[model samples]
Target chain A: MKEFKVLMVDDEEDFVRTLDERMQMRNVDTSVALSGEEAMKKLEEDPPDVLLVDLKMPGMDGMEVLRRAREAYPGVQVVMLTGHGSEADEAEARRLGVFDYLRKPVPLDQLMRTLKAAYKKKIEQAMVAASFAEEGDFESAREIMTGNTKKK
Target chain B: MNESLFMGKVTAAMTHEIKNVLAIIRESAGLAQDLLAMAGDSGFAHKEKFLRVMDKIDKQVERGAEIVTRLNTFAHVPDHEIRREDLSSVLDEMLILSHKLSRLSGVNFTVGKGSTSVVLEADPMKTRMTIYRLLEFLTPLVGKGSEIQLKAMKNSHGLPSLGLIIKTASLENFCIDGILADPEWNSLEMEFGSENAAIEPSPERDSFVIHFV
Candidate 1:
């Protein structure tokens, strides 16, 4: 199996195609969704370890996608990629439970590092949930998997 | 708040779209390069040439993206009513935005280095429009193949000023006084006056100065 799976959501087809190729070259399993709605669909069909979504897109935007994805699939980590960065937008994305927010033309090394860290976090969460499930504490395991701790 | 500002907002949004387009182009070219590298010896016969072409595409995408980004900033200039700004950067942006118009008039605009950065307290939208109007007024009078040099400086009174020095032959025929007296100049003067600014004919007939106090 691939090291990790990532879903890239953007309206830019060429960007997705190229970035998808680059991620694949780095040994990451990457999928592309052209719109926010399509991204939500992809999440339901095959939830990945991480999601890299563009902030501005037709039909639905990155923020909405992040909000819905976190609500529906709590296991997936989302990183917002935006061409336009503003304090409010970044704050809003963070409040919506994005793992990280990055600007466009992100250097490959930096992006890779972020992806690796996020993927690691996902793995750790799964391991913790597995431990709880093994103890037959299924509800607590589900809570841990969904990041529903009262402190959070 | 005004029509120009509304249009600027719309144009700014469009420029963002253009940036996205450039980003996609860059990515596509990058992907092509990646595939070429992966292909190894089995890749297309003209490997070196193909790589060079990709490099060219990447460079052009960068250039396009930079312009879009600048245009986006220009589009947002009207968002504020008045603010402190570096006049040189403002001039550079307006020159870029009006590049096509200058080309149509067969005029080229260049910015000359000033002793120091001239920061101004003014309405950015009106300031740009004022400079554009000056260019519009002079481009035709200066004739085709003319060059205009601009500089940002503090005037004799130490007020922030923009200097437009026309570099063309036969300034005798193109009288600054007569042009300044025209109705178009009056309208431009009124526009600047609305923003509590003034456009004055420089002591030398070769140029004009915009003063923002």
Candidate 2:
């Protein structure tokens, strides 16, 4: 099995630390950022397969982080893990192409399942883009990789 | 905002923080369980006891999360000054929130599973307070080891109401008449009256009806 890399961004230090440990135990390569700014910096440094982000933070909220990541690294999938989220926030997250929306104190098994699904999605998209590139259709490959082409 | 609304905002924020705490505890316990699995048989001592402890931690975290989630929902009750809310669901939440008070006052609180859509158009905060005050007045008179059943009902007038029945093996020291005459009950009645609601008691059946307009 391929190791799935995940970047978990939450302002709660203890939660991020413990979750990081648990995800590592499950054979996932997990990294943590204490704030949305730090998460963006980490994204720039090394983009992971899935970005597990919290909706609320002291500065540069998760929605902003998600927006910037979507603009800069369209390939990375995002999953919102929020303690305080309203229906409007969830709708905005969905509109922004979030892979999943989950509430806090979620069971680890459920979280793992979502992460796996998101990782699989990221891998499948990458594989499709690679296939198009190998077929010498660079424009189609770029369109697929950047999510500019609608699925048929 | 009124006092209740202000307090609701504060409580809602705290519940979010509590959720984060519960999540951390859950993840830490999960990590311990995962490590134990990797440790295998010979690598650890008292493995069974350790696993049991981990299981207890997981269970407690789940219980705590459930309580906090309910509290979070309750904390948001005052957000709407007046709204259409299901009476049965409100009573269900009040039952859980009042569990500790019932236990301490030596009363058992039970809510009957009624029609799910018994909704009322009223002030959410006032509705909760009315039910809470009724329980407060009844618990002491009902005495310890008494059973109380609360049911959401649609009254004869086609309005949503709450029915509270108290059953005691012995009513020796319990006086329903005196409880009804109490100043607190009078004040609660006045408050309910202001909300276009009424609190009435049936001495024959040892029950109370909270009628909402």
Residue-level error in angstroms, candidate 2, position B123: 1.1
**Model 1 pairs in collision:** none
Pairs of residues clashing in candidate 2:
none
lDDT of 1 by residue, A1-152 (tens): 68899999998887787899888998999999999999998999999999999998989999999989988888899999878756688999888888999876655668889999999988998899999899998888778767776543
Q: Candidates' DockQ values?
A: 0.35, 0.72
Q: Tens digit of lDDT per residue, candidate 2, span B74-123?
A: 98888897889888888889988898889899999999887556989998
DockQ of 2: 0.72
Q: What is the TM-score of chain B alone in each candidate?
A: 0.85, 0.92
Off by over 4 Å in 1: A1-6, A11-14, A33-51, A57-60, A64-79, A84-152, B102-107, B113-117, B140-147, B156-158, B167-187, B190-196, B204-206
**Top TM-score model:** 2
Which ranges in model 2 have alpha carbons more than 4 Å from their true place? A124-152, B170-178, B181-183, B202-204
lDDT of 2 by residue, A92-148 (tens): 999888889999889988999999998888888889988988989887877765567
Q: Per-residue error at A82 for model 2, in Å?
A: 2.1
Task: State the weakest 10-residue window (summed lDDT) of model 1 chain A.
Answer: A143-152
